[model samples]
Structure formats: structure tokens, C-alpha cells
Target: MRTSSTIRTRVTVKRTTRAAAALAAGALALSLTACGDDDKGDDSGDKGGGTKQPGVSVTLPKLDGESLSVAAVWTGTEQKNFKQVLTEFEKRTGAKVTFVPAQDPIINFLGSKIAGGAPPDVAMLPQPGAIKQAVDKGWAKPLGAEATKELGENYSQGWQGIGKVGGKQYGVYYKAANKSLIWYNARVFENAGAAEPKTWDELLNTAQMVYDSGVTPFSVGGADGWTLTDWFENVYLSQAGPEKYDQLAQHKIKWTDPSVKEALTTLAEIWGKKDFVAGGASGALQTEFPASVTQAFTGGDQPKAGMVYEGDFAQVNIGETKAKVGTDAKVFPFPAVGDTAPVVSGGDAAVILKDSKAAQALATWLASPDAAAIQAKLGGFLSPNKSIDSSVYPNEVQKKIADALIAAGDDFRFDMSDQAPQAFGGTPGKGEWKTLQDFLKNPKDVAGAQAKLEADAAAAYGG
Candidate 1:
């Protein structure tokens, strides 16, 4: 159920068909052909001269004719934009770099390649736990001095920590997705005479008002279980705070804890509502990722639901809807469940798997503002690099997302599911996905889901 479009991040983890085909399919459309031409940099025309990008001050070792293998799950626009960065790298250092889409479960791909003795030189590891896994397995090399220095100069302390495993820096975060958004149709809210909610109670009231106005309260992609994890994570982070969030992510606390039940109960109230969900409980199982956006923002006829909860990537799909962004299509922070609004995120970390002058040079450049600014100016991207200027973002949506990410500072947490074992978070048909799907089907079974989650988590984490 992997998404078929260019959104290669956790956005479409185990996506269903409806998410792409039902709406915004073209938004995330696959780029079948290569961006063969030297397109220069982002449309900002800043890199139009084909010169090296800005903020990369380190003197790179000339690895002329040196080849490097880089792998990730990127495709379509994501791939094209990244290639532009690589193209800049090629121009700067005269190194020939090839990007290979790592087959799903990249850890295994890297594993098989390592077992065969032909692993990639550098790879963008999207799953945080996998970075830990690679480090634990001794498959990743520490970032060299140049890259480590760039990371220190450009990235925030939190971001630097994400790439660190076992007290050593092993990766650089290049692209990020702010997952704290709740996208809604302005028309729907206006029709219900509802304003944006600041607290959890207000959010619940708004949903009820929208439901009373003849539209469903939410369009949930229950079909894809990861969405459920996001729902829980946001609420849990806000309710239990970051320290407890860290404990849960590391499996230091059991899933059957009362705090776990409290979070699930909060989620169940909305997810469990009979007519509140777009396709109802059972129908939601058939509604994939993109379709959830489509159901809320679709034009003509009454929308299936009034709102959808997802990451900033929803901007691409929202733009495709008849609703106009900043007007008809609007976003609000996922309402504060506790005293504070939670901002959760996911991102890709570029790590060096094989050490070489070429790898170190490329890694160093990737951590700079120059590399991120290229994509930022192009739109539809977010980077945690502190050196990147916000004006480079093409629109308010991306800009606000980056701003929220930066403002979160010490409060922000990487996608917690991504920080856990793949068995508990990464796998699609088993573990969290299956058990959460069961929870969605029968929301009253909070105790049951808690038990199942604890059982699965215990086995996955080996405690």
C-alpha cells in the first residue's frame, strides 16, 4: 500500500488507492522520465548561473570522476528537486553521484547490499529507528569533520540529536514534514459559523457543529494505520508532554499504561463517532490517505467531511482541491489537548554508509543552507537547517510550517512511530497497523487495543 506518488516520506506509508486516484493524484503524480536537463536550481533563479549554491564555505576535496551511490525512496517532484541539489553538488565538486530509490524497508535493502559487499556510499535514511538500527549493526560510519561541522552550524540542537545514535553523529536531516496540521474547508467552517479552536473542548464543539451542519466531522484515513498513530501521537505529546513522549517512543513505558488508554480514549471519541467520520467506521477502512483529503476539500456537492488531519504535505493535495488555499482551504494547529499545542514531524536523514572524501563532501554540502534553500525556493519542501531563510519559501503554508517547526524548539518530537522498531511502527499489515485498524473498527475496545498494543510492542521491543 505504499503511495504511488512523489511524496516519498512517511506521508503515504502504506497508502491506499483512494488517496491518489480519488483526488490530487496528479499533485503527487510520478515522474516517469528523468529531469535530464540541467534545470539549474529552484525557480528563484538564484542558481541560474549554475554556480555552487550559497552558505557552503568548506573547501571540498576534488574527487573528480569519483562516484558515489545515494539511495532513498524519493520519486517524481521530490526526486527532481533533490537531483537539482545533486546537480549543484556535481558542479561544485565534479563528482558523479547517482540516486537510487531504496527498495521499501530501506534497512533491509542496505542490509542485503552490505551482506553482498556492495552497499551504497551514502543513503538518506527516512526511518529514525532504522538509523539507530544501522548504527547498532555497525553499518553506518560517523559523519566526517566537515559534515559534522556543517550540522553544528546549520541545524538545531534537536535536529542534531535526531541524527545522533549512541552519542555519535551519524546522519544529517535534509527535508522535513510538519505533521501538526488540521486542514479544513473554510466554507464548511463558515457554514457552521465555527471559528478555529484554541483548546480541545472548542475543537470538539467545532466538530459537532460541523456535523450538525450536515457534513461529517472528520475524513480519517483509517485504512492506513499510520494515520491513527499520528492522531495518538499528537494528543499524547500534548497531553503527556515530551518527557513521557520520549519514554513511550523508547519503549521505556508499557503501552498498557493508563496514559495510553487516556490518549486512545481521546482519539476514540472522534474516530468512534458513528456519523462523524466521512465514510463512517467501516467505510473509513476503505478510504486511503489522499482520499481523506479529497473527502474534506472536494468541490461541488456536499463534502464527505469538513476536515482532515495530516502533515504539511497535504498542501500539495489541498492545492488540487477546488477550495482555494488561505481562503477556502485553511489550516489550524491540531487543538491543544493539554496546556500547549503539539507539533510532531517526520523527516529524511542523510547518512554516510561508506566513508570517502566524496561522501564527506556531499554530506557536508547537504547540511548547509545552500542545499536546503534550493528546495525551499522551489516550494513544497521543509528543512530544519537554521541557516535557511524563510523568504525562500514560495508560499505561506510551507513558511508557516517551517516557522512552527522552528518555534517548537525543545518541544518538537520526531515521528514517534519512526523512532520505534519497524515491527511496531514501520510494518504495514502487522503490529500497530493491524491492531489500530481493529481499534478503529471497535472504538469502545480501548482496553482491548491497549492490551494488543502492549503485547505487540513487548514482542517488537524484546522486553
Candidate 2:
């Protein structure tokens, strides 16, 4: 039920300003003070035993007996953690909030709901294209004044601009991902005497050393084609530079451009080697994303592979293993392929779909640090809201990732495939996903791959 369309917007991520950071710090300090004074019998109503949650001091209008629903494509720990944030909102505002499970290509899922006249009150959209689609369909509503004010006070200009369509705010980006990280098992590195690589060639050398030590060097989730796209994006962004990256993302240049060929040729260095990949190419082609992470971290000193490349959220999968992050498990920035390492990010934006007062209240609360701080403390989460204190994150690894993302400021790029039209970027078994999977199976066919990519992109972009 998902409708496909061309996406032309250029989504850029920037860093938080010093002034916004100061405001965030002040707000967090005030919340900490409120937490300290909980025992003083403050009138903040506590529905269950008067126990107050820390980092939740946002003042919301009382909507006792009001009912609302939120939709997002989150499952497992991600869903559980977000629900805790919603529960806190319900307790604080006396509004009953329900979590609605959504499917991939959430726009399609929402299309069905909107047609049925039962769209959720609020939806956490994962792509800017989806937001634009919703707005074009006239299903998205502008954020209320309170929410807009909170957004300006807490977020950077770049982050604010991502949610704006035709210069009107429609979304609040609540969760962010630092996608340019390579996570490795500490034991494997120590056993192979391998150091973290700083450049593309060095990474190959490290992989060779790991392989020489009789361990697979990398775990790739080839079954999920989006994971393959992530691999290509990191390499492309670092090697081709941001200018070329922007051009390709917007389809201003053809997929057959020299830059694309060069990036693919560089990726061929690793993909061309069968031993360097976990389970070989065939085995990897069967591996799913979670299994890919678990394979690299679950086997103690002899994990299936030595490393995995993914975002900050990979910690959620690492949690399912016995390896302790930052100790048994460690990470480094993606190695530089050109001048410097790349910083590619992805995030979920909360947008109002139904114009009810309670729905608007929820959007306003999501923009506040109070809501973000609750999830940030629970781990496997990062917030662009500069107001949330870094100490809330459970460990040094997540903290560093969050810091690096904010530090990137204007240099950072949103996920490339995500910015493209859905037919070309978001769909599985099609477009870049399938094309890259085919390239992985036959890394030598650079020309054929380029031709197919250009054809698919041209059709998707309506060239």
C-alpha cells in the first residue's frame, strides 16, 4: 500500500550551537534539581505511588481521560524503551497513550490508515521523503506554537530545517544514529595483534591480519540489502567527498559517473575477497542484520568474524551477547578513504497526523529534553536535542558516538540512499539494494553494475 514517489529535498545535518548547548545544559540542570526535590512532596501528581521519574520536568497541560496513539516501525528493545517515554508522559499529563506497531515503508502503512480514517494521532517518520509525502497528501499538520518554540530552543538550525517543508515545521527529530562506526571484538583484535585502521588500505591490512589469524575479518548482513547500502554509503562518502555525494544523492549526476565507479572499485578491495567475509559470500548472503552483529560478538575470543560495521544502535544487538561494550567490544570511526573519515547520520522524526490538542501536546513534549533524557538513559539511543546531558548515556562508547555526531556540525551528511526516492533507496530487493547485492556477488562487474544503477535511478527519478 506504500506509494512510490521522487524525493528532491536535500537533508543536511549540522551541529548544535554554543548558545543552544548552554540552554540545554540549563534545562537539564533544572530537571536534576526537580529530581532532587521529589521527596519534598511537590505537587507534580504521581499516578503510581507518587514516584517521580528523573529528567522529566517538562510542564504539559493536564488532559485527564484523553486518549491518543502513536505509530512507528520500532520493535524489540527500541519499542520497549520508547514506550517507557510514553508511559512517563501519560503519568505526568494523565493522558492515555497507546503504542501502534507500524511496518517498513511506514508511509504505505499510514496510507492505509489515512484512507480508513483511522490514522494515528502522531507518527515517528523515519525518512524526510515520507514527511514530504505526507505533507503533499495533506495528511500532516504543522507543529503547534509550543512545539515550534521548544524545537528552536533545543535543536540546531540544520536539524530544524530537515523537518521543514516549504518553510513550515512538520516534524521533531527525536532519535539520531551515528552510522560511520566500525565495531570489533577486543579479543579478536588482541589475538591477531591488529590495530584499528585509519585509512582504507590500513583496514584491508587489518582484515588480512585477522584472516591470517584464522578468523573471518568481517560480518556482512547481505540478506538485508539496506545493510549493503550502508556499507557503500560510508565508503562512498569518505572516498568521493561530500560534493560528489550530494550530486549522486540528488541524482544531479548519473550513477555511471566516475565517482560512483571509483567508489565501487574501492569497495571491491574487500568485497572481492571471499575469505575476508564471514561465512563467505554465500553464507553472508543468508545473514540478517541482527545475526550479523551477534556473530561478530557472541563467540567470546573466537567469534564468527572479528568485526561489524554499523551505527550506534548496534549496541542493542551487542547487548544480547555476553560481550561487554567498551571492554570486550570496542569501536572506531570509519577509516578515511580520502581526506577524512565520513560522518553519515540517520534519525526518526515525530510528526503530528491528527490535529487534536492531546496529539499536539505529545509533539511538544517530544521536542523537550524531558522526553529525550528518559530514553537516552536507557541506552542504544541518541538525541539531537542539545539540552539532554551526555552523562545520561550508559557508557563511554555511546557517549563518544553522540559527541562525534554533534561535533560534525555542518560537515555531516544524512544517509544517501535515505534521501533518494523510495523506489531507488528505501525498497528491498530493488534499486540500490538489489544492485549492490548483485555487485557483492560479482564485484568484478563494475561496468554492468553502473549501467543497471543508472537505469534504475533514471526510472525512479523520472529522467
Candidate 3:
């Protein structure tokens, strides 16, 4: 890919029934606890008025005397920050709110619970695949027209339409991490007399030049089988644009398209040169994700390494372990390849459940400008509300990324695996990813790989 962004693949979203069965088999259950009167307790005092607003609302027959609960994956210091927000929300609404902070695996647990007929009113999911699973099983409720109206013009059309599966709105997304950009060590490129490339061919030349200098151009771990997939997605995007690929994911287009072959051919050329990727192909397959990132940031970590393409979330991890942005690091858009336009991939949506007066209140609150500000401060995400200013970004790099995304216009889209069947990652092992990576290793074999992928996708889609 031309720019420094890494495309990611969401894992196979197991079949809806399987998700339900897994939920049932796991016995994932939650019990509610009462929150005694705090300043944030119900303000209405009217028997029913007590049922609405900010904090814990325990009015449903199943949760009577219980408190309003919100479950999400933010933990430790982040969780503490979220709780502080909840406390402030409670103080403002007099609603008793309970925050159930959990771990990543809990998504499955939540999915299982939802399958068995219970789900958290809200969750802070970092990805979209699980939400797709929830919506597919009819376990999620659309956030509705009012919520959409409230979203105003604050976000991009891509973010607004991300949750609308099969023309029916399913969930609201509030968290997002942009992945169509690359962060690199400014000093390394400067010292190497290299400039950031804006087009695919230039990028390849840069990679080869860096390799010739004896430094690896990229650091990645393909062992998990997911790492190599990132490069593939970006390649597909640069070659095929969004709408056509969306059709491909929906089984409306053939994987054997010339565009697909071109994308795969590009990846094969890179993979064929053992010196391009930090570790050769085999070494890449054995490396670990976090460690590979660490290697990218080591001082003068060039010729051996100069750049790494990843999502904005990597900034947090990098901050925690290495240098901060603008100083030790900087990011640029993934370059446009061949005749393709610049493209970006990331951003999430928000879905509302419950639909009670309180739920409606919460949805309204989330879709408000004030809510977007709070999310910026607390969640570190770009708000979907159009009224919010770009000043909310934490750094210049973020602002540049956002500007690039906005400029991308219709070219902005989500990764196809995020738009495909859940078995996308598992059954096919690498699914479309393997096809692209394999083709990169042998471009002349493109037709065979293309045919194989089409067959696999057809079977998966039951075409």
C-alpha cells in the first residue's frame, strides 16, 4: 500500500446459531446489584419518574429494585476514567448508574448472554464484527430514526452507514480506530534521504531502497495468520474501491475479478523479496504482534526497520511503551496505488437498545454535541456528531488522519472481513487474506488463486 496504513481483518463471525449455542454453552450470566441512594439516585421521585435518567434505572419487572447498568471493555485506568464519567452522568441525571467493566473475552460472554435472552444495555466494543453477530441473530435493536436524526451532520457517511446491515439499522457505534495511515520514525527516513511516498509505485521503490540499505522496510508478525491479511485488505481497497468490494463480500461479485488479481499480484511482488518485510516470510509468520511493533520504534531502527503501518489504537500502545507522537513518531496516509484513489478504513457506530424513556434519553445524550465532547475526553474517539469541531483530536497526527479520511470521501470504507461472514477468518484459515498473500508469492499463479478464492467464497456464501 502507498501510505503507511495497515488494513485489518475481523475474525470469522461464527454463524448466528453457533454464536447463540456458544453463549448458551458457556453459561455466561450476570446478576444485578442495588446502588443505594447517592446524590445520583433517581431524581424524579414519582414512582415512574424514578425509572428514567442518567444513573441506574431499575423499573423493568426483571430488574425492579436493581440499578441501571452499562457494560464495556474499558479496564484499569481507562475503566476508572469511564466510571468518573458515569459518576458525573449520575450527578447530572440523578440516575443510579452501575458500571460493569469486563475483559475482551466478555464480548463472547455478552454474545452468549444475548443469545440466551439477556444483553447489556451498552458496550464499548473496539471492533464491529461482534456487533454484526448480535444484529444477525436479531439480538440487537436499531438505535432508530430519532437517534439517527440526532447524529446530525457530525460524522462521515461511512460511519453513519456502517451499522446498517441489509438495509436495517442494527446498532450504534461510538468507538473507532483509523487504520489507513502509517506512523514512522522521522529521523530514520531523513537520515536515509528518503521522503514519504504518495503513490504505490513510489512506496515499493522506497521499500526496495530501504531494503538495499540493509534495513527492513516493514515489521510484521504473520504467525497468527492475521498479520499478512492487513496488507491484503489495503491492496484490495486500492485496487477495487468500496462499492465493488462490498458487493464481493455480499457474494454479488466474483473474487476472480481482474482488480482482485491485480491487488494480489502487488502483494506477491512484495512477499517474493525476502528483504522487504523485516523478517523473511517464515520469520514474519513466527513473530509476535506487540514485539514486532517494539522493533519498529527502536532508535535508528532502520534498514532493519523504518516504518510500520497500523491503526490509531497503536498510538496508545506505543505511548505506553515507546515515544510519543510528533516527537519520536509521525503518521501519513497510505499511498494511492496505480490508478486507484486514496482510501481510508475505520470508524464505528452507536446502537441503542432498551428503548425505554431512559434508553431514549441515553441515546439522545450519546448523539448530542455535548456527548461527542465527553466521548472525546473519555473515549479518545472521533465523534459521529457533525457539530463537534476537529479540535477534539489528541494530536496533530490524529487531525491529519481525520482530514485525510474526510478528503477521501466515498473512498472511505470498512475492511471487507468486517463486512463478510463470521467463518471468514476461521474455516478458510486466512480466507481472502491467504489468497492475496499467496498470490503475492506467485503473481503468475493469480488465476489459480483467484479461482480458488471464488470457489471458497461461493461455498461460504452458499451461492
Candidate 4:
């Protein structure tokens, strides 16, 4: 399944229904609508009197009548906030940029477009593997000097390296996700008298306390297999360490390796305990990602589960409930299963496909702090750009997430599954996704799961 991106919010009460409704409508190719009235004033600078625009820092060349099309999987509030960023670019540079909604596995969508000679001028690729695929197919363009400079100045070396293929920079990572978080109901934690856990043993103790308080400790979105992959990735990254994580992602190490077994065994501790999970293993298999979030935050003092695990984007679903984030709903880092806590992240990278002056300019603009600040303020967004101040984010929770990501810097790892081929990692009911879901249903069968995973991965990786 393609990872869905949504806006993270500070105050999401009013946006709850609209945001959910937009997501439910699916990733349709919605046309660009006017975000707000465009200023007819001087397009030179500072349209808001003499005050600088929030995200406008670099000077852009005049593209008076230039038109460009950009494609991505973002819809709903995510698309809306991004359009706001595009709107600012339009205002400052006099470019006509259109938002083209592309589906997941965006490379497939771009393939047909490239064949038809109608590819978007630019595309926001969600996975690093997709970026490589685009380049391998000779469809991606290298970043211009300006964009390259912005990337060096604003982003960490780790993020910059993710966009590079064969020693050349081909992408600008515009949006980021902190995927190793566990959001829980503050009231449930209070009722159980459980404190935030810092280690694997502590986490289990906390879970037991919540279970003892008559509430399930965790909500697993088992129906969506990607959630299951995340569960594995966090444990694997923390326990086996980054070296082994990369080896497995590249298929240099087999899934049946002892390190893999160790990770699965660790995960089984939670997955095996049916009483520790909301609705048990069978019911969890029916619960989708959205429902998992709602189950944790919907009930007043006794929600279905005390916690849900996912990226910061879970806050979008949490918004659908009456509970307020950072108060009623609070988050903690995924506890350390090994010597250190895991920081597995995912992000969207902006790459030029149909290179042009306008397209390159827009690509360079996105690399600047000016462009990031716009969406950061709109909420439900985080940027890897170190140049952007934490205050740009709408709430402290988001600020902390952004801080953690930047602090990890070059030490952090991208989502392990995302770095693998789509057939092995991104597909919905196959490869790692399916294998992990089956493992979730039968946590004790670590060896069986490892065998199945190795077979599928070998096929996908052409071993």
C-alpha cells in the first residue's frame, strides 16, 4: 500500500470532518483551485505591504507566462497546504503552476505520461527507491545550481544523500515524516499510572499496567499491512542496528538471517499477547489504519486502546476525535529495544521530470526555507530543512517531532521498507506487507515467517 500523507494539526476540531471526507474520496486527480485571492499588487516583493512573505526568501526569475505541472500522491489537506506553497511561488514569480494529483507508485503513473509525451514538469516522489527508478528509466532531471545550493544550505547530509543517485543529486526532499512515534490517550496513561517508557522492558510494563486498568494497550492496524511493516521496522532498526537494517533493505542479508529472527522474536512479545492488543489479533486484522487511530482517542476515559503507533500523520486521524492533541492525546518516542531508540523516517522528494526554466525555478524554491515555512505554519507538516525554525510549526508536539528528526541528522535511517523495491515492500497484499500481516496473526511462528519473507524478497529482488 502507498503511504498516505496528510496535514498534522495543532487545533484540528473544525477540520476533522473535511479532512476525513477528503481522504475518503481517495486520491483523485483534483484540479488546482484558488487557495485565496491572489494579490494583484507588485509581483516584485513583499505583497503584504513591506513585510516579507512567510516562506519567500530567495529571488526567483520572472516567469510571467510560464506554465508548469507538478504531480504527487497528496490529497485532502496535504494537497491543500502544498497548493498554498505553490500559490506563494506563483505570486512571487508570476508562474502558472498546477497541482496534478497522482496516485501511489507514482513511477507507474509517470511511465504512461512519459510514453505519451505528457509527463508533469515536476513530481514529488514519496520513496527513495522511486527516485532511483525514475532516474534508472532516464526520466528524472538533475537539480539546477540554485536548488543544489539550497539543499546544501538547508537540509542535513543524510536527507541530501537520499535524493542522490550515482553521485548526482536528482531530488530535493520537501516533506518529511517521523514514523517512530507512539501516540496514546493521556487519560488512559493517567488511569493506569503508567509513565512514558524509555526501554523495551519498561514499555511492556507500561502496557501491562494499561491492560490491568481494563484497557487494551495497543491498537494495531493489521488490515493495512504497511502498519505491520512499520511495527517490524522500528523493532528491527533498534535491535539489529542500522548496519543490519541497511543490509536487509538492500537484500544483501536474507530475511531468514538470525538478525531478522531476533527482530521478529522481539515483535512477537507484543503480537503474541492477544490480551494486550485491542480487539485481539483477529479483530485487529479487520481494523484499518484510520480506525486504529480513532479507537485510541474516541472514548472519553476508556477508549478501545490506550495507544496507536504510526508516523506524525496519525494526528490527522486523531483530529477526527474529540480529544485534543498534546493534551488529551500525547506522543512518546518508540522505546529502545536495543541500546538506542529507533528513528525511522519517510519523506517526499521533489524531482524535475520535464526540465525547464520554470520547473527548475520551482524545484529550487521548494529547497528553500521560504517554501517550507508556508506549509509548516498551516499544520500537519514537517520539513527536514534545518534552516526552518521550530516556531514555524503550529504546535509544540510538531516542533518536538521536527527537532528529533533534525537532531538525529545523519544518524537517522529512512523507512527500511521504503528503501526496498515496491514489489517487495510497497505492494499491499504481498512481499513484506503480507508476510508481516501473517506473522502478526501467528507471532510465535518466527522461523515460518522468516522463510516466507526470504522467498518473497528473493523473487522481488531477482535473487
lDDT of all predictions, in order shown? 0.74, 0.76, 0.53, 0.76
How much lDDT does candidate 3 score? Answer: 0.53
Check candidate 1 and list the clashing pairs.
Answer: 19-290, 19-291
Q: What does candidate 3's lDDT look like per residue over 138-220, in tens digits?
A: 65576656566655345556555666667665555444445555666666766656777767788788777666655788866
Report the number of clashing residue pairs per model. Answer: 2, 2, 31, 3
lDDT of 4 by residue, 1-463 (tens): 1333422111100001223222211211121111222222223353323234553567577788889999987776577768988987888778899999886457888888889989999998877778889999999999989889879999878779889999999989888866767888989999999988878899999999999999999998898777888888878877887678878878999999999999999998999986888888888899987789889998877999999888777766776788777678888777778876666556788999987989988998899887888877766677889998876676666776677566655655566677788778766688888899898889999999999999988998899
Q: How does each model score on TM-score? A: 0.85, 0.88, 0.72, 0.86
What lDDT score is found at residue 76 in candidate 2? 76
> Judged by TM-score, which candidate is best?
2
lDDT of 2 by residue, 1-463 (tens): 1100111111223112334323222222121110111111123344433233453445577788999999987777778778888987787778999999887667889999989989999998877877888899999999988889988888888788889999999999888876666889889999999998878899999999999998899998888777778788878876777688889989999999999999999989988887889987788888877788889998788989999987767777887888777678788767778765665567888999999889988998899887887777777777888787776677766665566556544444567777778788877688998999999899999999999999999998899
**Model 3 worst lDDT run, 10 consecutive residues:** 28-37
Instruction: Flag the better candidate by TM-score, 2 or 3.
Output: 2
Model 1 ranges off by over 4 Å: 1-61
Model 4 bad stretches (over 4 Å): 1-55
